[model samples]
Target: MKGFSMYIGGISIKNKIFISNILIIVVFISTQSYFANTISQKAIIEKEINNSSRELVLIQNNLQTLVSTIEDYSKILASDYRLQNELYNDLLLNTKHEDSKPVGGLNNLSMKKTLSETISNIVEPNTKIKAVSILTSNHHWVDVGFADNAYASRIFGDGYGPEDRYYLPVWTSLIKFGFLYEGEDSVFAVSKTVIHKDTGKMIGRIFLYVKETTIASIYEEGENKGGDFYIVDSAGRIISSQNKAKLYRDFKEAVSISLPETGKDTTFTQGSGSEEMLIFTHRFEPLKWTIVSAIPMKNISSGRKEINQLILGVGAACLLLALIVSFLLSRSITRHIFQLAKTMRQIRSGQMQVRSPYQSKDEIGYLSEGFNNLMDRMEALMAENVEKQRTKAEIEFKLLQSQVKPHFLYNTVETIISLIKLGLGKQAIQAAQYMANFYKISLSKGDDIIPIGEEMRLTESYLEIQQLRYVEYMEYTMEIDHDIMSYSIPKLTLQPIVENAIYHGLKLKKEKGIIRISGRRNGNQLEIEIYDNGAGMHKNQIKAIMDGTSVPDEINGFGIRSVSNRIRMLYGERYGLQVESEYGVYTKIIVVLPLRYH
Candidate 1:
């Protein structure tokens, strides 16, 4: 089983599904075929039986109409005063001529002729009647036959039963021709008693024989097809049948089957030997008779065999269809999967631009699009990393340059010497001490970031040294927020801007210029503002400086631009320097940085 599973797994999905569905289709066809024969056999038998019952119902209706008409004939004969007087006169004549009875020979021919003519007038009009006869209370009788040699005496004799009771009509069970005649057979009839309408007294009994062939005609189709048909009374006595031997036989004795209590249509099997037959029975409630059909088991089995073969043929066609559909659906799904897998393999092998070409709005299509988007983001990040590296190196070189610039050292040394030559030892010592403090904080042990307090101290020392050098020409003020003194900022960030203010703005002014430096914390940001009341430059000059287009001419020392770039590089573009100035009024440089405590 394990090996078989591996074999199936190795095959393409289309073939696997085709194979699996073949098995399923086989099972389905097998199950359907079994049930089709098992269930449909019973269903077909029931439907055929019900169909036979409907045909029998039509025959029953015809029989009822014939019987009802016969009853009407009896009423007509009883109500006719002329006919009643003739019957009474015949009774009197027969009593007087008792020796002239027509028993062994034809006696009283004239009387018989007159009475036969009278009965013929009524029974001859009805085509369904084979013979009609009357028996008076005094035992005088006469009969007329519609068919040749139809012996009314043989068909119905003096034997009187409940069916022949006075003033009531009833149908009799089948009986044979009383006196064997050529071409004569058994027959049944509807009989009633005739009465004098005015006196309401029973006169005599009268009977009408209906040809047995009429009952046989009801099931002519079944008989032609070699099947037996029967009409039985409610007592289960066969009243009429195609088979003369079956007529008058008890139903249970002939077929060994019991009728249902509801008298509905039913089918059953009877007999075990060659007599075995499929019997279908339907009861006609109006006639209180059950119509039955019997077909041999051999005949019924032959038809069932044909039906089974047809069902098998249809099942085979459905199985083939399922196979084709399964193969087509599996192929569509696996084709998309294969394309995605191939594209993923290419991507794994460093072909980042490769993509699956599935454009359908399905799950596979979504996965393909997601894969392509992921590649795009990866490529963008790679380029951004390279750019960041280049910018970092440029900022480092500028910081190195600022730390070792020679003119800054030379100017500070000359300022201290001039002060020393004036014999102002204390001021000279203070100037030297301030320069020492500024360099110590600016270097910050080679670290680029320092506390806000130390950065401010560095700027203050440089301003004090510059003030001593320009005494009357330079004035400075510092307004530092003590709360933000511990916040971290880029080292030497403020000192460069201050130096630019003095060299570019304050130094060029004629009157003593004021340079104010203030640091404070604003929301999530730390801001240091440098304002100079000097000869401020125009917007064009500030733009050129910010854009790195202006060349530094020894005194500017790349200080402002370097500080702006370093602030942006370290804390992102949102934290940087903004310059605001007016020509000859005031120049304000605000350095913004993210607030971070050391």
Candidate 2:
């Protein structure tokens, strides 16, 4: 009986041991799976945020580039106005000489050759003539290129009726505008007034032909740089395109597409009947035209695929690592270790409230609970440090603000004295009055935010003083949006920008240069830009200004660095000075700030 009882007890003990082992294995597997999933999800979320932020930055850069190109084209077109006016005047001055010609003059050949040579020099190279005719004031037309059978055939067409020749709307418009036709074509024609050179009396028209292809070629050469380019006229018709026929046949359809309402960069997808493309449209205000550049969407996205793949690969590796770690540590002790590790990771990632799972009185559990208490104390200390830093920044900003006004006043008074010595009494008196008004609002009894109008007046006072001192070497202009002038901005915000432009940009130039001060409202933000058409800095100089690494002792333009620091101190790092320069052309400094205090 004793032997049988012992055997039963042994069986019961073995069963209990086997069941405990199995339970431990099950717990380990479940914990491992949870750990792997958490790691993979965290990595994916981080990658997504990083990629999204990078994409936003790239898009913003591209938009700015597009806007800059449009502005450049507008400036180029504006410079062409004088050339167009000159051409118009030349036509009106030559009206009398053609009328003096005899009906069958013997010297007609010599006169035609001389006139052709003179007009050819004025026109651009590679120009072709289709028809040269003299039109009388009474509406009679005389064909000057009668000897050229091809020209006569195209124009006369075996008769003198309108149907015999091509009807040119441009030519008709020119004639109505008091131009004497010298040539006619489907695209453009040239005409001069029919006045005798000696008598200067209106006689008849001297017509010269212009090749439309020549002007089109000029514009094409100017705009082409490997991308698809097209020009849309003021009326929104696709007048010319890199692929002529593709756009020509669908002119009405293309015209109906909405352009960017403002002078902003915009992107659109355009195509029909197997001709799809991505179009980037930039407005050229001076020409009253839109320059559209198109690229294949597939091509642009193909480059992005590699970056996408890289991100995916990194994500996959992290997920695989998490899975392996979770599977390997499936025991109960390992589960506790993983939980503790996760809690530590959360604390490191700034979640201070996280705590380890510990419910036992064993050594491991005691250590975990003690670690959690330590983390709580550390978090409290960190919070105190953050508050201290905030207070310090506020105090430093106030000190900088206090220093700026006194310095500005002393400089203004010195400038006034100099103006008085230069025999400019009335100007000095006016400047002093402006100085008083400027300081009244600038001080505002230590107010941090002041009206933008007050800032503008303060800037104008500084500019006025500088202009007086460097009258022969400097010019200044201001453009402020009326609506935005009432918005408040940081005090002494613009002085450093003006100082930088004059000292760094203009002072280096040998000849007198221009400085432009402009402002505009962008949503809830106020943008103030100071640009100088003077000797610009190199890329290295601009880089040093932005990074704040360049020392003031090394260069004379320390004011730029000061302004940048003050802006950062007041508004945070996101709002500050942005400097851009092209060697020998211009330098621009932009200061961005919120319209109202946060």
Query: Estimated TM-score per prediction?
Result: 0.44, 0.38
Off by over 4 Å in 1: 1-15, 28-53, 77-83, 94-110, 122-125, 140-165, 178-183, 197-203, 221-228, 261-288, 293-315, 321-598
lDDT at 394, model 1: 63
What is each predicted model's overall lDDT from 0 to 1? 0.73, 0.58
Tell me the tens digit of each residue's lDDT in model 1 across 252-282: 7886666666777777877776777777777
Q: Which stretches of candidate 2 lie over 4 Å from their true place?
A: 1-407, 554-559, 569-571, 595-598
lDDT of 2 by residue, 1-598 (tens): 8998887576633344444555554466556555655555455434433443343334334434533443333233222333223222433433434566423331256644543444343333422343344444433344333223344345433333442132221222111111234433333333444433444444434344433343345345442223455556565566556565544333447544455667665666666534555556666554455656665544444444565565556556655564454445344455565578789999887688888877678776887888888887887887787667557645645554565567657877887898789988898887787778777767788786788888898889778867866888899999999888887777777876777678777888998999999999878677899999888889997887666677655223455665666667666777888888898889988888876732
lDDT (Cα) of model 2: 0.58
Looking at model 2, which ten-residue stretch has the lowest summed lDDT?
Answer: 169-178
Instruction: Give the candidate number with the greatest lDDT.
Output: 1
